[model samples]
Target chain A: MAERVMAEAVFDDLIHPSTRLSIVALLASADWADFAFVRDRLGLSDSALSKQFATLEDAGYVHIERPVTQHRRRVRVRLTDTGRRAFVGHVAALQEVISTAKLGARSD
Target chain B: MNGQVSESEARLALDAVEARRQQVAAEIDVPGWYWWSVAAGWVVLGALATFAPVWASAVGTVGFGALHAAVAPRVISGRRGSSRLSVRRDLVSRRVPFLVLGFLVAMVALTTAIALVLDADAARHPALLASGIVAALVVTGGPLLMSWVRRRAVRRLSA
Candidate 1:
């Protein structure tokens, strides 16, 4: 029961925001993706994507790289190990919350 | 942050996770060049096998297989899609290699069966005919087939 409570407490506020959660979820599946790809997929404006990237970067949840390819600069994003851990924990916490709710409803 | 999360919010969050995962799965694709190269290679190899001497054809087959083995790993690693972003290693299904191998085996078997059937019909250049048919399939359906296979693999992994 104590473990259940601790597990429920593992929700990550940093990743709880919908936009940030979406970003982390996408990054969780790939090693790295370009900025344009994420923006296009998420249907976010360049500025909006950049702002989200900055927020995740500040939290050390994502690493951004700007590399020049054939004289063209491109930004790439990837989830950090710490970010992955946080996302996984938050997901587990969410699952726990749902399961606990289901159990409580059944008891009542 | 320590406040209790409501059941509804938790369910919503879980839905978000699934949605994001689906987005990633949808993005799992080999670059366009992969399909095009495969099509070209199929035609080239088919032509070579049709025209070359048996020894030469054997050498070509071995050489092409070796080249594919060497280069295909980099291309099919699911690292990069049409976008500049590289996919994460964990998200990539380990069954990818098997999927590719199975696809190749099926293609080879189809080509061989076509050749045998045409040969039985006394058709001239049965091998060439088989190659043309297989090459056409590769050009037209390779990408779609790859996409379908990747989706299935992702579904299996997620399950």
Candidate 2:
């Protein structure tokens, strides 16, 4: 399938790290995900997941909400619009890198 | 340009992104309880049709329909199969609920036809027999339908 080449292909340094990238990529496909679910799915410890979430939250790329339900509080995470844009831009940037290298090899 | 990353590394990153999307796509399903409940209700309605008074059977059918209507909105998208996450609306087909409902409607029609044939052949408890057959199909076929949905979601993501 052809890649979706966005007009703005900005490489986001904050989201380039492997762990953060995985988290963002997962969130990109979900409206909102439970904190525990994300942690379990990625095989990360609570502390480790919290640390990553804090980094994303500080960057305005993710929002954390603690909602009360059934007399219990649950943590849910969703990517902000800014974060979604950054992720899309980052993916486009990655695709560009590959395509540019392929073009260079073909020219040679 | 991401000068620090080589072409192979960029490719790997993109692959990882796709993998994550596939993981979410895999979650496209209705909860197991939804199937079980529907199957049980079908059998009960069938039993009512066979042995109960006509009014009782009518009420049972109406009750089942009302219950399904109440619950379908939340589960029919095959998005909240798990409480962990709700699949993004754009990622799932909007017609999934309709597909499920349509499948049920077809089953109802099939049951009526089967019962008619059984009665014509002088079989006893035709309604019960027909409902049992359709209920079995519902229990087994529901999950298969959701699996097809998940595969479609993955294919859409890959595309």
Candidate 3:
């Protein structure tokens, strides 16, 4: 399918100190990843990852399914439909910013 | 870090860059005194190959391949680790991908050089010439790539 309009909202979405981008990039590389996996990959402290996850979940960008198996805390992370859209758009927005940043790089 | 950001980001960035630098160094695990000394051996081997073509090719192959294995890591490390500035550390920090790219380029150059050396007229082979040009360009283009990476790190560092 053709991409949706890569608008200004995507840029606005990225203007945050949140670890959300790390979450998106990590999830984008894999279909599903455990919290511990992300924690190690991003090297984020427990509280920082928790705070960012809360923000992202509140925004409907992520779907957290807590499937308990034998007393294990398995918080599996997957991008929601809205999340995939926002992430693709967000990446396109960043690409736009990079290409148009006037370091003489042309639009691809 | 600007003496403001948390200790973790600083460390993660360090891990990201160091992982690849370490790989580049590790890949070229070779003996001492063999890198600069190989050129003399190569000339003698190159002359011998005109008579015993097969033996010559084998010797030349082992000789140059060894030379590369001995020197590749050093060359890559010298370019990447030249800077001491903290800002540069950030640029090199997440450079595992670049190291992979460098490895790929090395493979391509090595194969092409081998083929060129095996040709009847080694000096006239385009593969050899092309590989030389590509290697030179990569060595020269390093600063340009670093400058681009440096620009990104500077932006991230601005916070």
Q: Candidate 2 lDDT, tens digit per residue, A1-108?
A: 222323378899999899999999999889999998889889999999999999999999999999998998999999988898899888888988999999999999
- lDDT by residue (B29-148, candidate 3, tens digit) is 122232224433434444444445687668776876786677655444322332110111222334634553474467456646664665646555444444445444444454444445
For model 1 chain A, where is the 10-residue window of minimal lDDT?
Answer: A1-10
Q: Pick the candidate with the highest TM-score.
A: 2
The docking quality of candidate 3, as DockQ, is 0.02
Q: What is the TM-score (0 to 1) of chain A in model 2?
A: 0.93
Query: Poorest 10 consecutive residues of model 3 chain B by lDDT?
Result: B82-91
Q: Which is the leading candidate under DockQ?
A: 2
Q: Write the per-residue lDDT of candidate 1 for residues A1-108, one digit (tens) a residue.
A: 101112334789889888888888878777788898889778999999999899889999899999898999999888888787788788887887888888889999
DockQ (model 1, Cα) = 0.52
Cα lDDT for residue B112, candidate 2 = 96
* Pairs with backbone N, CA or C atoms under 3 Å apart (clashes), candidate 2: none
Model 3 segments more than 4 A misplaced: A1-9, A14-18, A103-108, B1-159
The lDDT values for all models are 0.76, 0.90, 0.49
In candidate 1, stretches whose alpha carbon ends up further than 4 angstroms from where it belongs are: A1-9, B77-79, B153-159
Tens-digit lDDT track of model 2 for B84-133: 89888877899899999998999999999999999999999999999999
Quote the true-contact fraction of every model: 0.78, 0.86, 0.00
Error of 1 at A61 (Å): 1.0
